[model samples]
Target: MKEYFNNIYLALSTIFIGMSVTFKHLFVPAVTIQYPSVKPQLPTRERNRLYVNMDDCIGCLQCARACPVNCIEIETVKKIPDEDLGLTSNGKK
Candidate 1:
């Protein structure tokens, strides 16, 4: 008999607790945002791309080492100080 009453008390107390939580949430303001109608603001600084100028690259593996994806491959010929190569597209010798 005592165990039966304990079980009934436990069930009622759980139901009361659950209903209190539900009532608390029912009175709270809704935090949901209407999507598609309102767009979120993006960050000002974008790091979505990596731009490199081949003219300025000296075949150093620093970029490859710094790259997170390890996708950068540099291939260049070492030119002699006296050797004269044609001007680049930017007109730099």
Candidate 2:
């Protein structure tokens, strides 16, 4: 009796709520974009990959240490400084 009525009421409310959502979405503009054709614009300073200048890197690992998120990596071998050093990728001496 009472339990049956409560279940019926719950079912009716659920159906109405779902229909309302469907109706709302039917009139809304789509947010989808053609991912394959649309290219995202990135800033000049944004880097999607890792790059290093082996020659300019005195093996100080400063950049790695400065990363707040600890996302930077550094690897160095102890050199006598007398070894032949190459120029950085940026042509910085």
Best by TM-score: 1
Q: Model 1 over residues 1-93: C-alpha lDDT tens digits?
A: 999999999999999999999998998886876767876667988466566777666678778877889898877789999997666658786
lDDT of 2 by residue, 1-93 (tens): 999999999999999999999999999996887766996778989866545666667877877876768897877777678886656778866
The TM-scores of all predictions, comma-separated, are 0.37, 0.34
What's the lDDT of the predicted structure labeled candidate 1? 0.80
RMSD of 2: 15.0
List ranges where model 2 is wrong by over 4 Å: 37-93
Model 1 TM-score relative to the real fold? 0.37
The candidate 2 region of ten consecutive residues with least summed lDDT is 47-56
Among all candidates shown, the one with the greatest lDDT: 1
